[model samples]
Target: MRRDQSPFLLANPRRVHAAPWETREPDQAVTVVGDFDTALTEVELHGRWDPHLKASAAHVLRTCLVGQPAGIIADLHDLADPGGESAPLWCAAHTWGAHTPSLVPVVVCLPTAAPLAALITCRAARWNLPVYASLPEARAALRSRAPRTDRLTLHLAPDIDALPLVTQTIGEACAAWHMLTLHRTACAVLTELVANAIEHAGTRIDVAVTRRPSGLHLAVQDHDPRLPHLAGAVPGDPGDSERHGYGLRLVHTSVTAWGALPTRTGKIVWAVLTAKSAGERNRRRPSTIPGTTAPRRS
Candidate 1:
């Protein structure tokens, strides 16, 4: 069957395949062999759950989380040595997912008779992570618990006109999602991201606006590989025009969390905005970029 015609993509048309990661020993590699659907992402793992394999698995899971899927189904039935030692990995992933603004859920799939089944269940129970005996069961459980999410995607050229269009889109998304409280902040953060892409990348930009239970999720993708960094200006200082770098500073202050992820063609700058009172919003500041392992801070 054609790659795009696969059942996974058929069920969720918005899903896309991500490049798979492999280890030095091909047989021991862990691969993300599923589509990245907004509602759920399925990650299938093979080979032993050794230290080296665990590192690759962690990276794969981290990348999947960056997409902000509503839930994740990790299928480890094919793993040669899915022992209890790797239980901590799933727990850590569950913790990471819980920390996201949307609180993405994660479930595992392994045979009931597998050696790691009981051990994983005991360890994962502390974090409330679920383990199913089959892929169908895991998928069903995750889908049942997945939060409602709405998304809008737009592709535009690297031009100034895209700014107003982006603003309009965010406004519509917020209104439709009944998240008017986040409309203003969402517009501000997304505008900065798109403006930066248009100014620096000078390439086509892909914009995504997603509404989650917490608030809004915004991402801008451009064909420029260069990641963004914050300016050296003081927190409250408005520097001279030549020294000005407040564009991202405004975004950093307005959103709950923000980070950059590199893609094959370019990079994606994403941010999450949670509903908060004006006083709380004013006092909020980002300590460290979350979701991705090596994210560029703004």
Candidate 2:
């Protein structure tokens, strides 16, 4: 992406590869990957029972399964967490298994991270999922299954003033394809992710939105160094009463992908939006409406 046009673009050295990238009408299949596919989809847990995290993980697995005719395989053997638990990753894996047409997901765990190594070891001991320590090894298991493709990574930040711009952009992108629901979802996910990043991550925080052919990406990075936890989340009292948390679950349903990143300072909570554009025309609306209450611009 060209940063000379925007400050946010500076942090990311992307080519925005679709040029003469004609601001041509949005097509459901414009960019290669939206967000999650852009990188290894990941989640970090401050607690063991995070429905939000679990639901988000399932969404990514489903995204990977789209347009494919085989099982979804992911590897977590190479992830940087050495002391975490596979139990945390199970939520995503199980969720993916339940919804998608596959029983297993290719999980790659990077053992370089001591915490991750321990986590994977324990999970492997408990389950039958194949665990690997390298990306290539993880890819090899799925290569013959599906033709791997391009990936894109974008950032989403909650902006009090950018809603209109975002709405217009998304509305234009999805309306052409009759994917109005996706537009509504983008609005909701952006609203919550941005709000959560700001309210929990603290000020000077900015929501970054990145788009690719496969999905839309959003993240909020803040200066605070503390890991964030929802104010009053409790483990499964085992009831249908939804887990009392923020709108993240809602976000999990709206987008095709989602995940979080840890920063040296504070953490960056991000989500990948997996939707396609087809040039559906429409008008602009509030960026932070309904499910979204704008977080103070960082």
Best by lDDT: 1
lDDT value for candidate 2? Answer: 0.42
lDDT of candidate model 1 versus the reference: 0.67
Off by over 4 Å in 1: 1-68, 72-83, 95-101, 107-148, 233-243, 277-298
Q: C-alpha displacement of 152 in model 2, angstroms?
A: 7.8
- Give the clash count for each candidate: 0, 52
Model 2: residue 22 alpha-carbon error in angstroms:
51
Error of 1 at 35 (Å): 8.8
Best by TM-score: 1
Lowest lDDT 10-mer window, candidate 1? 5-14
The global C-alpha lDDT for each of the candidates, from Candidate 1 onward, is 0.67, 0.42
* Cα lDDT of model 2 by residue, 1-298, tens digit: 2322111110111111111111222221111121223223332222222344344344444443432222333444322233454445654564554454323344544544456555555666555455556656655664554434332222444444545554555555555544455666566666665556556654556555544344555555566554333234456663323444546545444444454434444555555555432112112233433423332221
> What TM-score does each of the candidates earn?
0.59, 0.37
